[model samples]
Target: MNVTLEQARALDALARQGTFAAAAKALHKGHTAVLYALRTLEEQTELVLLDRRGYRTRLTPAGERVLEHCRKLLEAERELEAACAEIRAGWEPTLRIIFDGIFPAEPLLRVVKQLRAEGAGTRFHVSAEFLAGVEAAFTRDEADLMVSVLPPTLPDLRSYRLADLKAVLVAHRSHPLATQRGPLKDEELARHLLLTVRGSDPRLQLSTGALEGRSTVHLNDFAAKKAAILEGLGYGWLPEHLMKRELRRGELKALKLASGATHLFHPSLHHRAGVRLGRAASRVVQALTGVELPTPP
Candidate 1:
């Protein structure tokens, strides 16, 4: 049966002080209200709680057992309440962050270090995945934050542009495409095998060299795509950050199209705005990027 604070306190006070009037005084109640609390507790438990001998009241054997249980429970609740109060007065226990595959990992590591320096005592449990995969995490309550390339459709998610990146087509310097026409002409590009992300489809054919009839290889795995290009398997396009070091060494070179344009990757930070993310999740967004992320209601 359920026991209220007043019932437990009234019983404890009466046992400790030995009188109904004094127990009611200890509970800051009228003698009748204290009597009512005790009565309700007794009814719920189906146990006789007090023995009244004229104006004197004492605990029965059953009341004594109930009193022991009540005292322990009440003391434990009080300790929990005190601990919760301390938590509210100080800081959160931990923070969960979700980062996309494209979000610069090093920058996030720096942010974590900075947070530690500020004495937040906040620990971040990060779940990182591709932007598409990150959306799944939000839906399943697996991630508190999501950083990804902005999806054209996200009806229930909120996002803010956090950073920009450049996407470029690159190939091993030894590739046949790299040896093609000096000006890197359209006709020459069409003659070589093309590699691209499967989802982008050939419609994202950024290069006229990537004409409709060209031989092509579509890949979804990033590591495989990179390994293929490095082994002189084919010409491929990738986000610049992923190939930054190789590009620096001239092992790979950017493909320049007739239009002289390079692709840009814009990273968006997303969370289930106005609803899903807890307070610490929101705070981390503000604290890290100085941007207020939105939420769903």
Candidate 2:
């Protein structure tokens, strides 16, 4: 009931690092200090926090629940500090960006490096989502800016064209479809398993680049989808940028559709309408908008 923030932080650190010594090292404090804080917290709360019987320290059931709350408290404290610092420096305290999985990673990384190089003080949090997942992140107020492919139209949202990505249907070389001659028919494509990225929306499951009525395997992320394709588990559309090495190495073969078609995915940057962007966010937007990625050959 009267626990201090330091005590709460020690509990969180101890839960994460699994031992007082490791937690102390992470917190840049003496081991005894970490122990003292956690013990003080336990005494104040009248709860047994650490189970010290095993080789590795662990949280008791009550400790686990208490630590969960501590984590939230710590997160809020961090945000508060960041906000104060940003206000003092005339910058936005934090910027949250969610990028679609299909978007090229190299350019994003470059932009981040450039931001750091400029000594920008804005705290950045970035995450990757696929398909409707990107839009969902935005709608949930989880991000301040989003880069997405075919983002759903929403009221009070503004969008700008960021870049286009080339996507091609592909499968592992060992897959039977890879041996088929000429453009593959829809029926032929449907017979094979389709690896699709799962959407984040709980109310409505969504998919892109998937043939209707096809046998499918849904994966959580692009990396998992690519891995499934590499394992010959299924064929699916992949960003050309991500599969270049695999294609060059003959590990994956592009599937020629009946129309001999490849898709150009237009990814756009989005932000809430009427929301003023912080200096760092604006710079990031400018850098990304100006970036010119090489067209897939």
lDDT string for model 2 (164-226, tens) is: 788777899999999888978877877888887873333222232346354777888888989
Which regions of candidate 1 are displaced past 4 Å?
A: 1-96, 116-123, 182-193, 196-198, 201-224, 276-280, 292-297
What TM-score would candidate 2 get against the native? 0.65
Model 1: what TM-score? 0.56
The 10-residue segment with the lowest total lDDT in model 2 = 199-208
Displacement of the residue 113 alpha carbon in candidate 1, Å: 3.0
Question: Model 2, stretches more than 4 Å misplaced?
Answer: 1-86, 199-210, 291-297
Error of 2 at 296 (Å): 37
Error of 1 at 66 (Å): 30
Give the per-residue Cα lDDT of candidate 1 at 84. Answer: 68
Cα lDDT, model 1, residue 119: 53
Candidate 1 lDDT over residue span 1-297, tens digit each? 678877888889999889888988887889999888889999999989889866779899999999999899889889777656535644445666666654567767676777667655445777665546556665666465677764625576677777677767777889877765545776677777776544343323355433534567766555677878988887766777788899999998776666653666667776665554534565667765797645322
Give the alpha-carbon lDDT of every model. 0.70, 0.79
